[model samples]
Target: MATDLRTSELKEPVDVAEYLFRRLREVGVRSIHGLPGDYNLVALDYISKNGLKWVGNANELNAGYAADGYARVKGISALVTTFGVGELSAVNAIAGAYSEYVPVVHIVGYPSTISQRNGMLLHHTLGNGDFRVFSNISREISCAVAMLNDAHEAATLIDDAIRKCYLLSRPVYISLPTDIVQKKVEGERLKTPIDLNFPPNDAEKEDYVVSVVLKYLQSAKNPVILVDACAIRHRALNEVHKLVEKSGIPTFVAPMGKGAINETLPNYGGVYAGDGSNTGVRERVESADLVLSIGAIKSDFNTAGFTYQVSQLNTIDFHSSYVRVKYSEYPGVRMNGVLRKVTAQMGQLSIQAGPTPNNEIPQEELLSPEPTITQAWFWPRLGQWLQPEDIVITETGTANFGSWETRFPRDVTAISQVLWGSIGYATGSCQGAALAAKDLAAEAGADQVPRRTILFTGDGSFQLTAQEVGTMLRNGLNPIIFVICNEGYTIERYIHGWDADYNDVQPWDYKAVPAALGGRPDQLATYVVKSRQQTEELFMDREFVDPKCKKLRFVEIYMDRDDAPKVLKMTAEAAARTNAKLE
Candidate 1:
């Protein structure tokens, strides 16, 4: 029998929605990202009441993307949507977050339990009235799912979903029924926070793995440390930095791990993406006798279309769940503990002089007389202008591939969906990243400069999520956005259709978009650059770079339709071959 709130007087009973929002606040979710739907409208009221900001996104998909970005910066985030239509619309974004190991709690609003019990057809549901179908679909991508049909179990389920999302570092799904939104649950549960601590590895197993890693470290003549996206996802970057600084081995990052290491370090080699790597990086990484690979995810894009040449016999792989030393496998042992122990116990080995990463633009491109903004000239040139601790976001286009050449300053966070390859993700992601940066800056007080969220996206991709700019403006966020106006999907063109009509996109006055999106003229700045000199002038502008200027800086950069970054060209050619007929 259910505990009737009207009949029985329970002490300190809390609404289900209030409990959920409070839990989100406890987990560092300062803002709730989603659009209000009819089913979820009442629940939205609890967001601000629980000390959380409600980010009303233009659409559900963009909301999901924004939540993903927030999670990448703030550790965890929440998204709310209506049951079927809204939740289905955000599926692609949720899938992308799952693919990239981002923790976003996707809370969906469903019809009342009474409606479902009577099999009544609902607006957001299928005609068959099966309420579980949507959640069934979500289980494919989500690490955990909580169906809140019963008020008794609602609080427990919500806690479980959120904990799994953080521990597993992936998306989770929660279904909140309309009638259940205000259902009374035990308020005392909120007093005890969810356990977010990772379970420690078995002491004996960890010791053995650490010793095995140490043995290989001492004997190798040439050893290198390769960091990847998982190092950031699994929160092992601190351990990675300690090992890199203490060991002084040649350190390199995969394409997806661009910002994991400090580029100023003496042992920091540039990105090592097989054929796409700078010649120095490829040769050094491939020739090494020993490689300490931390949290590596060698996807096609990450490895430059499956071109990584590192041998497994020479590599020691460290992962969140386990560590592999050469051919030996150590299961149930986590990387954080193993890496910490390995760094502490390891002795000195042969430390060779490694390549130093730099941001110097190529001499030929700098001296070129061409007026058009070429990829080769723009990427390295932009590197010179980037500041410390900047949050740089790149779309899955030329911007993503081109940015591999740019060496980042200390503490800069690079956000991109490289493995998922989701187009237009950067714009929406930029909104959440800017908000997170704003929150962080406030916490740091007036002494520290606020981190700028900069976005580099192609015109075609920008058109997909342009409405997100309006949301950013409404929130008073300051982000520097660059739209590469090449007139089409340059990446797809390079892959299959060079001159096909399918790849072409209609041109728009991108500079006029913010104003049309309701930005005040005084608060917004727009620019158009077609030449290298103009680009340089904009980069050096004092007002543009000033943190005090609280304006959205939007720039439209024009380049030839056929021009693409060198790395993009190589990777595109490889992708084409992979899609070609077998011999």
Candidate 2:
């Protein structure tokens, strides 16, 4: 059955670089962070020619942090750099993203096939000679890795790698050989959009686990639910709230899971940690007979370095699909649906609620009678400036303390890569979140309307990815950035105080850096405040919030670096004494 087929003229082949650029565009990635190099020249040229915005960083670590910040706001982030050195420098940030379950796409350019085959001393290559040094580094952290040796596999691999990352909520690496970046391919481009479906539930196992959990809940006089980072990262807040409501059980959130439940809720006890530990909340948790831990990873930082034991209590551990009951059985199931179903069933079994009466600190016991320049002063003032829909990103040191104290509005969102406790993640993440907020506003038909995106970063952290200010100006992102100028790594200084001089950094004119980076003077404003009045006056000013201004604002606060936040200092000192007692 050989019928004569009508032959059509073939179309011109598309440039491989252009094809890659278009694919990234289709995936909604508008910004890329990294330093340019010879190996990535072709892609860089195409990206610039096609009007894509590329953000250059001071170092690869900062680049990855910037991408992480961007992803926190934008839903996904991309980082592009030359192979080996660039990729290696960015590893820490990417690993932080992995630990926090943030989605990021990392692209690295490799040496051409000819260069790799010949034992040439390539730039940035170690003695191993193989240009695939990234594969080894990325194996443990990245959700998946795709190396493009053949031009035919480039498009498919890139698409697949991106899809896998989004699906798994982790970083994915794609290694593009220089030769493949230039080779043209003929085909319809891969256009598969990522699917973000929740992992499937195991009904039978879920039912069995639910029965066991119900028994413990019924038997225990006091039962509390401890929510951690995974709960918020997985967008399981609504489900968790349902579980809490149905069980009529008191709830306490981990520091990383601060805002998972409405802090204003009647059942909300407060945060549970050593120093930041709400005494009333801890009493409830400590007295509990059953503790249902949902999406809680037993990290040293979260569990007070495993100093708090859960072995004695009737605890049910819930992971992605597997669940284990202490002194009982381990069952595996889809947690999302299982949790929902169990909550619904438990709603029928009535349990008395624990005491969550609002507990306020006595004025006499407060840090100081007169408000001084401290995180406590800054937090409440900062809270007053927040509106619904505003996004708050905090760094590890002072920002973490601020996160503990600051209350979020229902419309507001808060984010930080706290699991890894990486210092410089917030500044870069703020840039990305600001960019994402714009897109999100536009998608919701709120484009052209003013939106607020705020970042709280330590002096040490702000320095890591400070160069992103240029990208913010170039993209016209208006975010209020507050550099907590304590003058050093306050968190570390409190913990170790080893070589205090080394911990201290010479203070810079925080306001001047943005101006030097080409930010419009009118749109880009900086302020240094030493008093609460100054902080309030600057933030409450009508001109600063003018919708028409569309400016990027910077505020710096000068405080005593040696005088750590009261609660944090107390905790650190207590921890030191505890360690001493153990020794």
Candidate 3:
């Protein structure tokens, strides 16, 4: 095949694999996560050469989950997998990434163009001649899809796909044919970086929306700010914080928004999940005359099974695409610009000061005088032990619901899959988050302390992706992992099958996993605590949480299988009711 004449004009020509990896490195991806297959093996070699670390995950699904976690922490991530089987294995994770707002570049190594054109049967493909079936499946979940069969078009497609992934904060798919991996493209394109700036909203429409928001705000006697998942995913935390502090209005977060606000603020209320809200948060938010909901995603689980009592008539919702004030919708008006204007223009408000929302854990919720580790006690206690800037990842089960009670310290990031609710997501997410923390720490140099990555997962959920722990050890990442050993899927049991065998999971020796996965004695630490006393002792121990300690610390806490968080019980019952509805 003759090379295109346009390619000969370039001073520097690089392989297609080199261009793809370089683009990923340029877009803040320090590491690439994936499992190597025969098709993708050659492309994997270009990862390290382009200054990006290759994180060989235990499996493709785990790789996808790890990529999701990495993106949550690092703002963008890249995942490489082979054609049919590997890509299909990761579809669930990619779908989760799409449902929630996460930016992950999914790169699939495809069969050669010749094989695809001739309809030659490939080992990983279905017996059918169609090679586009897998890409079609990905199109449903991905924000953009790029097929790199032509060398001339590969650079343009790669750039477009990555930009879409970053700007949309959603997954994008790219199919790289094996024959095209070594094809040369203009290396000069590397000199110019991809355009990442979000297009500016219309000035006239933005002004109108901001004015409408102010009109409501200036008249609101009791206006409260509610933050949710999109606030973090959309990169609006800075604006959200400024609004929270500048306005001094009582503020609260939904379950998915756990770490979006600073808990230490006097006006900062706790999680407000409709019926599952903290002690007084439900009443405080419900009684407000005006509500400023920023980046709100009122999913069933997020809203405590759609139990939110806030009326749309009393709410002003600011979203990435548009602004909704009462029943009026301002299309094309973005929240970031609108918020900046709202905060800058407002001088003062003629609003009555309300009582501060109570964030205190009720005295009755404290650890019982008895020896057991109840859900209520353990969650509240956890808040007291967490440090600033901690990266906390929770599973979709008990840990997700129970964490609502744990108020985060300033700058801490909470990662969970509330909307997607994938079972084994946390373990793989932990590995990626830990790697991101390590990377950030290294970039910050020796003077700064690396933020700790802590994971809270039920034994049942942990069993699904436990192999990622081996990946963590292989990479030498130090993260504190707490496995709640309740013998089965407690969350599932609470939903319907109270004592059914389907909800049961095999009990494994959680502490022995690190050693079995090839951890040296000094490289990691393990503990099993049954009583509240032991847990408290371990938490209070200075040596266990010392910032200087690099050992991977794993703790197994034994709790009764029947016990669950109060919020979980309420939410689960609601879920059960909704699921059984004949309508």
Predicted candidate 2 versus true structure: per-residue lDDT over 137-243, tens digit per residue: 89889998988777666767777788777666689998877887877554355444544566566666777877877777677776778887777666566788888
Output the worst ten-in-a-row residue range by lDDT, candidate 3.
351-360
1-583 per-residue lDDT for model 1 (tens digits): 8857642564678999999999998988889999888888888999999999998999999999999998888888899999899999899999999999999999998889999899898798789978889999999999999999998899889999999999889999998888999989888888899999989999998998888889989999999999999999988899999999988999999989989998878889999999999649989999999999998999888888889999999999999998988888888889999888888888888977667768787888878888889998888888889988889999988999999999888888999999998788999999999988887776678766668899999999999999999999999998999999998999999999889999999889999999999999877999999998899899989989887679999999999999998888888888899989597
Cα lDDT of model 2 overall?
0.72
Which ranges of candidate 3 are over 4 A from the true structure? Answer: 1-3, 351-362, 365-367
Candidate 2 displacement at residue 352 in angstroms: 4.6
| Candidate 1 global CA lDDT score | 0.91
TM-score of each: 0.98, 0.87, 0.98
lDDT of each: 0.91, 0.72, 0.90
Residue pairs clashing in model 1 are none
Write down the RMSD of candidate 2 (Cα, Å): 4.4
